[model samples]
Target: MFGIHDLALFVVSGLLLNLMPGPDSLLIMTRSATQGWRAGSAATLGIASGTFVHILGAALGLSAVLAASATAFTVVKLVGAAYILYMAIGLLRSKAQDGVQAPLALAPLPYRKIYAQGFLTNVLNPKVALFFLAFVPQFIDANAPHKALAFIILGCIFNINGTLWCHALALFTGAASRRVKLHPAASLWLKRTTGGLFIWLGVKLALAKQN
Candidate 1:
């Protein structure tokens, strides 16, 4: 119904796509490992909200503009890259504390800040908008009267499934992290390692081609 075809196939494919390792998953994992489940949940909610933006953009045909215009895509990509780089720098600069009331390797961000970070990280990436444009349309019947509605439906399905996976990821990562104690230096290194990865991701996004 609702101008959708191959509903089962869509669900399976969407789940598989959600399982792929990407920046979203990385952010959730990082929060879960370092901060705990609540932090991860905050990140997950932020990401889910951002994905809704993509869904709305796709349904509104805004994503098509990005596909059709090289300039628009480039501008967005550069902005996204810069933001990612800024986050990486923050992580890389985090200092470990010793002999304090509650000494920790990397200071955790407040839930609000973490939530905003997750939202910005997801919203700034034009790739996700493009992804929705490419992926969601396939399940929509071309002859459908309400193609946009169908697209939104598919996007929601994908987002819901992805959110479920993210929560599980956060839960497990947090639980496992609690079981392992890290040296101050090691935790600092962990933060930097993640930071380094974000840099690579930012660079790759900056260099992404419109084609």
Candidate 2:
């Protein structure tokens, strides 16, 4: 069990980390801007689901393998980067549609695919796995019975906090859907911009060194 002081510190640190802009936030915003509220929310859920995997990996000490091995890190990083780059290319290649339809209705919304993208984006990123390995153990009681369980509990708390923050972000970014719908050109530009961001993120990930 965590002491009040440790719990408070964990909450504060988690909030700070969640608020700091990162690849996950970028992804959520991209989906919100390009797709709509539903898609954004789906992405959030997908991200949350992925976080659970990292949490479990951390609890089981599996993430340490990724953290310690340069080859493992590089392989995961490149795969994640490749996936995101593929998404970017698909977005760039998409034909512009002319319509005043609701932004969510711009195309057939594939909720499952969006969710899969979110899940894969997080799970494939060795950085995220490494982060959980590093971040969650600090507050764990060294002498606690069931250290793994303690880690899992703390990770669950972090995931819950992060999920809520992401949901709020999705709603805020999704608000732009109305404007996107009002201008067809806006949709094209938004997709292009999102695609560009993904490309940059992909390159950055690919070139990242294990820390």
Candidate 3:
């Protein structure tokens, strides 16, 4: 259903977005570094699950509604921004206790909670929904047969590419975190940087226009 140009564009776009240090990537790194590979991988799975919801929305035309309705877009954006700010506050508070020499291990959070957190983090971001709405359409050939199927195929490709890339990042960061487990100062700085990134992205997302 996809042409060579379409596949190339999807891969290039996905890679660029994956490389961008957004809230999702920052969250994955923070969780991995703090909790280890298991937690990081779990969070990565959660993020992937969330992307599926976006894909579903795109498929069902809900994303088009979100693109059209300012009120709906604003509501989702506010929720996402608030959530990121909350995460930032938690990280900042942890920084205050940086003197403690606690080993970095994944706290025993419920699996469902971890999964839901990851899912909601991405699902609630209006920008992501709108992006897919605008982005996927560009690759679709209006004159082609089975256009809907074409979009769905491309969406799955994007999701798979994104999941693999992010998972690799989580694994690598988790390994690095193991080596630096004893360095509380370094961990503290990493957490602070992560928290800052989330807050900054949240603010930028909140301020984004509907265009």
TM-score top scorer: 1
Over 4-45, each residue of candidate 1 has an lDDT whose tens digit, in order, gives 776886686577557645688778877877899888889999
Measured by TM-score, how close is model 3 to the native structure? Answer: 0.61
Highest lDDT: give the candidate number.
Answer: 1
Worst 10 residues of 3 by lDDT: 95-104
Residue-level error in angstroms, candidate 1, position 11:
0.7
Reference-based lDDT, each prediction: 0.72, 0.67, 0.64
Q: How many residue pairs collide in each prediction?
A: 0, 0, 0
Candidate 2 lDDT over residue span 1-211, tens digit each: 5411257756865775566555676677777877776788898899889999988977777344443554554454466567767867965665567313343333435989888888988888987877665555445433344556776888898889999998887887788654433245655655666667667656755675544
Q: Write down the RMSD of candidate 1 (Cα, Å).
A: 10.2
lDDT of 1 at 96: 65
Indicate the worst ten consecutive residues by lDDT in candidate 1.
97-106
Candidate 1 residue 143 Cα shift, in angstroms, is 1.1
Candidate 3 per-residue C-alpha lDDT over 1-211 given as tens digits, one digit per residue, 9 for 90 to 100: 5421346745665565555455676667667777766776787788888887887777567344553554664465466566666766766666434533423455657656767777889889987776666556545443334444665677788888888877887788788874533245654665676667666655755676533
Supply candidate 1's per-residue lDDT for 164. 96
Indicate the TM-score of model 2. 0.61
Error (Å) of candidate 3 at residue 207 is 29
